[model samples]
Target: MKPQAHPTLILWVLASLLMLAGCASPSLEDYRNRQPVLVPDQFFTGELSARGVVKDFSGEVIRTFDADISASWTDEGVGTLDEVFRFDDGEVQTRTWTLTPVAEGYRAEAGDVVEPGLMQWQGNAIHMNYVLRVPYGDGTLDVRMDDWMYLVTPDTLINETTMSKWGIDVGEIVLVIQKK
Candidate 1:
């Protein structure tokens, strides 16, 4: 005869499993059947404009900006997205992303990105994760960026990016991009 397991122990284990399940992040597959169906090559073409805000960890809006973007694809299918941002504090910045199509999605690279990010889309949503180096107090800090974009219309897209460091949420960016 085998000894029975403790009821309290069984309940604690089940509760721990439930908590872990709740912590799981969303996957691109989860949005596979969503609407609008975003195609990067088609939607990110031509001239575009964006307006957005940056929020700190406490959810306070720290900055805002307007940007202009020019996107084009090469004959070989490589794409370029040139962005120029004008901040409310009278500062200007620029970042250009090179996108190369791959089997799963696109490989996205920028000057400030520590590594190429995998940009994948299903239905109307696109997701990308990358590490970015940003200016800090004296030098710079590398932060993880999780980007999600949704195409609401043929000409409009909404983007949200969460910035984290050391597995802790640090900031967020929310923006809208529209074709011009």
Candidate 2:
């Protein structure tokens, strides 16, 4: 008689496949070359407000915060975004992003950014990949971050950030920013 595959093994294989399929990550190449209607310098100009949450690898919410931001075009295609962040635990911090137009798209520099960040957009989504120096204990952790921004409307933008360390998923940040 021919040997048969065990039922439990078959079920495990199916479950693993389903989980992998459901966990597919977003790719910029999926939307490349499609002209996105996003004008970052224009859409982010004036006053803005944002609310966001930080979640751990298992998707448990770790923290939440809000922010008030001011954005303006500085000179030529260069822009500045000033943000003041207030955390739920009563901690506050500030970050400034200097955005300069580049040949590919834009280059962003900030205090915690290890290197100049690169940005690319297609369709309604903008992708920014960078290494962020996150405060950990007394020092800082250099984490790879993939930040994606989707324009929902003229005044509304939703951003999602995935953070990883050593090629392993660490956490995520989800934010909704709106023009004021």
Highest-scoring model, TM-score:
1
What are the per-residue Cα lDDT tens digits for candidate 1 across 42-126? 9999999999999999999999999999999999889999999999999898999999989989999999999779999998999
Candidate 2 backbone overlaps, count: 0
Residue 7 error, candidate 2, Å: 28
Q: In angstroms, how far off is 16's CA in candidate 1?
A: 7.0
Q: Write down the TM-score for model 1.
A: 0.87
The C-alpha lDDT values of all candidates are 0.94, 0.88
lDDT of 2 by residue, 46-126 (tens): 999999999999999999999999999966888889999999999898999998898998899999999778887777788
**CA lDDT, candidate 2, residue 90:** 94
Q: Assess candidate 1 and give its lDDT.
A: 0.94
In model 1, the runs with Cα more than 4 Å from the true position are 1-23
Q: How displaced is residue 124 in candidate 1, in Å?
A: 0.2
Clashing pairs in 1: none
- 10 residues in a row with least lDDT, candidate 1: 18-27
- Superposed by TM-score, candidate 2 places the C-alpha of residue 155 at a distance from the truth, in angstroms, of 1.0
